[model samples]
Target chain A: MRLKLLGLAAAVALLAACSSDQDAAGTGSVTGATSATAPTTNAGAVRPGTRQDFEVNVGDRVFFGFDQYDLSPEARSTLDRQAQWLNQYRAVTIQVEGHADERGTREYNLALGERRANAVKNYLVARGVDPNRVGVISYGKERPAVLGSNEAAWAQNRRGVTVVQ
Target chain B: MTMSAFMTRCDRLARLAVLALAVLVAGAAAARAELRVDITRGTVQPMPIAITDLLGQGQSEGQIGRDISAVVSADLERSGLFKPIDKRAFIQDLVSLQQQPRFADWQVLRAQALVSGTVEPQPDGLVRVAFRLWDVAAQQHLTGFAYRIEPKAWRRVAHKIADQIYERITGEKGYFDSRVVYIAESGPANQRVKRLAVMDQDGENNQFLTDGRSLVLTPRYSPTTEEITYLSFFNNRPRVYLFNLETGRQEVLGDFPGMTFAPRFSPDGNRVLMSMAANGNTEIYAMDLRTRRTQQLTNHPAIDTAPSFSDDGSRIVFESDRGGTQQLYVMGADGSDVKRITFGQGRYANPVWSPRGDLIAFTRLYQGRFYIGVIRPDGTGERLITEAYHVEGPTWAPNGRVLMYFKETPSSDGRSRRARLYSIDLTGQNEREVVTPMDASDPAWSPLIP
Candidate 1:
């Protein structure tokens, strides 16, 4: 009941915040959700009725290749599941963060990351997810999922992750 | 040349260089290098110099003299144009040199040039500085200057003395009296905290402008003022902001509905050129700094960013993918006569126009490696200056004779990455690292301080 109330408050805030203003208070649930979910990296856990439910069961992130924004077959399969889960949670809107590896220049990587995020948005919208329910941002090479300079880290860093608000 | 070779073969060309120096200091001044490098011959050699401690009356003044002279030596040494002869080999004492520098004594140490100065502390709590630059080989006094400044400005005084020597010897405006602002990076790769940092061009007097509360990137110094314009992720909305160093106040450049980034200042410092990304389309925009009015320079469907202005602010060179790949394009300052400038063998990005208006520096990604290259504005005389696993952000010294960029080096296991700053000349030689306390990137060299 408490989480439901919080979700309702966030949904109201999101609607009142509208499409343009980047109000910091709009993501009340997201700020707490990240800290609670950061420690739960288990892949097999699939509990329902919580924010981690979407992250664990729906798989919030899709990876991309180096300097390549075109979705692969595996990424498409993941987005398909994400779109369904997002549609189910009517009050839960999401902000998709697109990231890139550190190999490219900062400005160019930003543009590349935007293309990736926009691609994911276009894919989810095509799958019948409401366009207004989804927001997009490109962190570029600033935020990395893993801390390494190797191919493994680079592969994980170049990704589009959906954050539930 | 390396240090050992510089010591052994230093005297061979001293006689021939005297005539060249005379012609350079007389008629070809301001457009020529008085140091060892001869651009026409494509040869690089650091001129040998002997720096002596400044004579002083009191103990504190003597301490200041030593500190000031050390800074001057370090400045010349870092330029890769002057090889300061070791002090252990000096035969002339400060007492004798203050009266009359014994040229044969310095010549025995293979010093082609000599610098001597003095420091005087005033009763009013101010300090006075006077310096002399002498051509040791020709036994002639080249330049001398005196300055009176507060004691807190000793580093600046030292830099000014170095600038006088550099200008008199090289026949070009000295870059010593300048500051460099860059991004000071820390934390892990995923959660990096970037702050704005500034220091002297020779890497002294370091200060952090921001406290690392928000992420800042690509800080550019105003060519005409003590202000910087950069992109900030404040409030989770990427926007361009102008920060005044004097007032410690930051103002958003404009209230664009989308991200405003890749910012640079015009040569006149009256406007800022940046990229505004709206929807899925990115284009270049120039905003009047005072009026906050913006004029879109490119109306392309593809990504267009990293816009830089020519010295006169009449033309802008930026990178765009309208040609199906990232390449540099030159357009008029009014967004007219758009023409591509780079036709190289790789994807070109991060195009920065040289301050002299003769060249454009960019990062070329080919296959997997990155190269920092310079190309003429007219799409000719393209040359690669340096290469690395990851190198980007080329900024020019105010004189336009040298360039500074950052290079990221991977750790042995390839799990961690370290980014550091480096400087290189237009001749593709004298590549030196500009050290910082922490990981650094996106360096912006300020104009010579007023």
Candidate 2:
């Protein structure tokens, strides 16, 4: 009880010190409050159809290999889970954003990203998901999730991310 | 040269002589065309040139005169064909040169070409400029011109004078009076703000077309230079958009079912050739601007992008993966007689046909490095001009004598990368970085402004 009160006091003091700087503390306090009353808020906070729930529970993205649109067994399994989750929510439509690593040229990378996205969409349709409920976009190496030029960064960058609105 | 072409040039010279006869009488040897610049070879010894300041009688006049003279000198020196000598080495002033050019004074400094001019402030808020080009070694007058323009148009007037000098000496058109459209980028790598921008070829008068609210890419100028076509991700849908400079009217090119990008103008500027991705396949298409009709050029399942038309509009050169790897191919404008043109070791893409129609510029990616290269139309005489960690999107000057491309260099242990624009001639020498306000890419050079 005493620690929770101190944490709240610190967050309030942080807000008063600098409102702009409290962006970091804002999230820290939320996490602290949730942990304090873990049992009640944990179940109530799980909005099943929310983007956070979809990302945490349903796996909203899959990875790809270097210069290849062919999905690996692991990526296929992730898409399988995605299809199952998406089928449960019939009213939701998702856009699959196809991305490529920065090792290639712009125009060609765009094509490669398109191929990867269609590969994901085809997998989902084959797994009993409605084709019309899904759309795809190829970012073509324009946006990267990571900011380094190494292999680890490239591996994370080559991906197909699903978003729900 | 053909007999008709030679005769046509002779007729032009005759006309010039007739027009300039009022200023002064021409000697017999003055009519002979000499001091030619051979641009065919890969290396050249720059011809020494002497550019005298345009004598202005007043303060503002002299300032404009000096500015105009400096611009002309910079243009000539940047072409890598002439070396403008230092002004401190001058023995004869513009007054003396206008009165009587002493060939011995210029010859002593090894200046084969000498330029002398004057700026006269007109009565009605205009500037009257007259200039002369002399061949010092031959001791003969080459050419001269006079113009009346507003003081605000001094930069353009300088470029025009340089164009005249270049045309008289090299027998080709000049690309100084031109503009380039590019994508200016800022912010982090993941959340970048790419805006469409246009600037003078010398990196002046820059203005942003888009407010950087939406992501834009790959802007290309039409032949008339009055319109630009580019790809924009507006409202989360990528489409091709056209902006008219004169009217400030913007519109989508056409309603396509998929993403449309890499749109380039044909020789006549009536149609835009671009690539569209749909149904898990990418193909090339041409849309006629007037009728709102699109013609699918490539029907292959493989990727076909970066289509550029030839100077005569009879053929096109593009990159296709139909041959298992990204290679360049030539096809008729109607999508017939498709022939593979590149057999090099690397994957070649971004093929732009030269304005002269003699060579095609392309980007080749091999072993993790990119190269800007040129090859013949018949798939012969391949030459790699510049290489870097990442360089692509080569655009041609109006004269086809120089190429501008974007190069991305890594800084600080390959964590952050920066893209900058660069230009290099066919000779592979005199490579220069074009300065910009921010990181830039996807440079598209426009034809000389009409």
Candidate 3:
């Protein structure tokens, strides 16, 4: 009976600590709770919260090569560098988008782009990234990197891009 | 000698009795196969039309003007819709190729409609042809246009005239000025190499789009744009993707948990309607673009695929086998109010709604014969448009005046096959093969890519 009481007391203390820290964080405050315990990794919840901050903001662009969904060796290296950068900003998630050149039809391109984005996802997962930390979608041929009809433009258009989640 | 003849007669009678018994047994086992189908006769009257031969600057212009005009007249006449009046019967001189026509002279010729045109030569050696469609009954200008094309394009110019006349009378758009996209097949049948091909509706100006590393099928174009959506076995998973003509970009669609096929654009160009197969049954789904949302439209356990939306996107026409056999069904875009549209003797597949919203074209299979037919939305006026050994996948020309479908013919080698694209007017006339550099199928007609 004494040991059971001790365990309950420890749990209460931890909950109190987490509540107080959430209060301090301001944006993630929890109300109606006893507030006197230490905080854990409460920010790692899988559910979406404060989606406005997760909007695809500017300066967070991704790139790919012509008619290829499989990332290039250089692309993988660049993504590795980006992963390191992401590690420093510990609170952010991301979305990966795949695209294709406009020579083909529309639906096929959409499926192709999805494959390319998933390729990036596979690489990131293999590199020890959390699968839930990334989401993927395909824009197909709807969006283009460059707006020209020549080969140079098409080569640039086939790509997968990373955006801030 | 008399005894030998009697023995031979007895032997022949015994053999005849045994043959008769065998015939009776075979007849009893023969399959009794038949379906009572009510097929209504379509209108046999040819569409009234007029084609005026363009006069040239002088006799020095030679046979070019007459030849071009004659070819156009013949094409229209062969369509079975138009009855082109004889050029010699033209009451008016229309002598000046560059001037407007005297409608009164055409009226005197008893032409219900009048096609008058002029031919001239540009300084760059190109031919400039001008044509106009006049409605003697309505007493107004129907359609008029001018084209500056190479001398070799004269035949196409002729086709354009016929297309315009058909559209003006029918209140539908003309399809003669468009092109068809199909898979060109070559090499041995088992190891056939298929490539993406594009050609004019009249079998002119054929070009290969893809080199055929992967298999492609069922290409469909945006009703108003140059974009196309088709099923490609590129990675061998059978996914749907988009190919853009202008930017030459290809992008894959959603990463479905299962195989995706039979994709088409919503009339508004804002969403894609497709079928995703899971557990051996296919269901229809729609994806909205502006917001990344997917909606499952049909939850039936049957094979519900090949969904085509009406012009306004309010309803969709698709093929389903919910009736124990493959037949066409019409339902609301959200998958409510399912109504059977075809009650024919055979199975119907590949139902494509016309751009004009007045007709639906489909492929029907019956008793070892394949047919292409069109029916109105209410299931009235059902008409079988074409019959062949094997025909499938009917696509409409932009104007909905012509249908382009593929036919497969048996080769000397039973295992080998040849596929070719053929086009015909909605009136079921003027059937001609759209020649490709190689065997082709799964044709999709694009709107004039200006």
Candidate 4:
């Protein structure tokens, strides 16, 4: 019962905190539930009882090859599928992060990763998603999926990932 | 004409046997190496170096030998200082004699020096690497060394060979075997968790020096490998900390009641020159590491930071806004002879004198752009190496051939920020990333490990 009270308090805090006039486009609010069971809603307003089961999902990541910022056919297809889901849910705005492998220089890779993120954003917009619904950033090999010095790890590092803001 | 003159000189010396051997052997040691040849300057003409693949003789098809030598060649070539000759142009396959090299074929390629080596596997899990440097024009063996290490150390062995070549040709020690200290970062933009990390110069064997409990920056390695002086925010207070790399002990540098940042070792490593900021103003101060006594070098009410020492440790070049704009200034170690050295189109900061006492590398901000540039001590011959969105904080390699610095990527939300470290030749070729687990920045190169 005390845990339930704490959950309700958290929900109230989130709602009160999020209502401070900043959130305009009406992305769904994550409240009350733990980070694992944070509800993802299709509408901009807060929805009750929409909390999914508590399983922390490791989100899927997108990959790039070498110095190329243009997405491969496979990357576009994946983004198209993601766009379809995004279009179905107008409330969700994704933070698209671009990354590069540990091969090239840092600043150049930062620009390259930004171009890659822009490529994904351009694709999403072309697929009828709102440009405002997506935000782009470049990590520039600062974050790697794997820590080995082998090619396998490097391939995983050359990637972009989308996280819910 | 240059080649003919060199060749004619070689021919004349060849006729005099004893004179030829003495001059050739010593000249082999002191060849026409490029510019500063110290921890401050880089090569203008790519090092005229050549390395031939070691031809192995056995049923075992020499793949390991080829791979090892190739790794060595790649390491040297990536430095942008050496022009490793193409294997296809090799006139000789001297795998039969890695120790006693034949210098004629290498000379024909106009390669001033040649690196020939052999890799042999022992009954144990060790590999014996024997390499020799050949003075192509002088036609003499410069120096040879051999070592036995684990198979995984083949890459390090390659680096060692390149080090020997660099030292022999440049008449100075090589920094290829050294490590770089940097701030490894992670998480978000505003609340970044930074840990001190050390990695090989080639971006391998990276390990964290500090845990993520505190934020660290501007790690400067002492001349001795035991200690480092860097800025740390251990308990939310920013101060300079002296960390012992061996014992993992850390102590605050001085009892200063202000923030101390941009700490660097003196040339002799006895004192640390840093900028201590009190109120809104900052000044340069030197603190003796052995004694906790501090000496104030600058009495500026402006933002005077990023203090660096000259090779002789008698003077310091620092960045100050005393002239209403950020510019490089040189002053005596006793805070006398204050003379401005840079007055150009931009504002310059972080003026680091090359370890060789020739050039100073600095970060320049001009007209809404950031640049990494090098200039003579007199502020002439200023050359901008790279320009980026936000590049800052350059540290010299032990040999001063390359510089490592950090750059930040702009985020749309200003929340999802990223920063990472990079290294480039002074000539701006072979630019590459120094990989870390998370975001990294503020790289400082350590002295050669051995």
lDDT of each: 0.78, 0.81, 0.64, 0.67
Indicate whether candidate 2 or candidate 3 has the larger TM-score: 2
**Runs off by more than 4 Å, candidate 2:** A1-44, B1-32
Clash pairs for candidate 2:
none
DockQ of each: 0.35, 0.32, 0.01, 0.02
Candidate 2 on B1-450: residue-level lDDT in tens? 222221222221111111121233356245547777877788988889999998887888898889989999998999899899999999987777888799999999999988888888878777777778888888888877777766766776788789877877877888997889999999767677899988878877677888897889999998978789999988878888998775567788899999998889999999999999986799999999989899999999999998999999999999998988899999999999999999988699999999999999999999988999999999999999999889999999999999999999877776677999988888799898888999999999999866
Off by over 4 Å in 4: A1-165, B1-68, B85-95, B99-113, B119-128, B135-140, B148-157, B170-173, B411-418, B428-430
User: Model 4 reaches what TM-score against the true structure?
Assistant: 0.63
Instruction: Pick the winner on TM-score between candidates 1 and 4.
Output: 1
Higher-DockQ candidate of 1 and 3? 1
Chain B TM-score, model 4, reads 0.80
As for TM-score, the candidate ahead, 2 or 4, is: 2
Cα deviation at B33, candidate 2, in Å, is 3.7
lDDT by residue (tens digit), candidate 3, B267-337: 77778889876433568888875674879988875667788998779999988767766788999988899
- Model 3 residue B401 CA deviation in Å: 4.3
User: Among these predicted structures, which one has the highest lDDT?
Assistant: 2
| Per-candidate TM-score against the hidden true structure | 0.86, 0.89, 0.58, 0.63
lDDT of 1 at A142: 85
Question: Residue B281 in candidate 2 has what lDDT?
Answer: 92
User: If both were scored by TM-score, which would come out higher, candidate 1 or candidate 2?
Assistant: 2
Instruction: Give candidate 1 misplaced runs (Cα > 4 Å).
Output: A1-49, B1-41
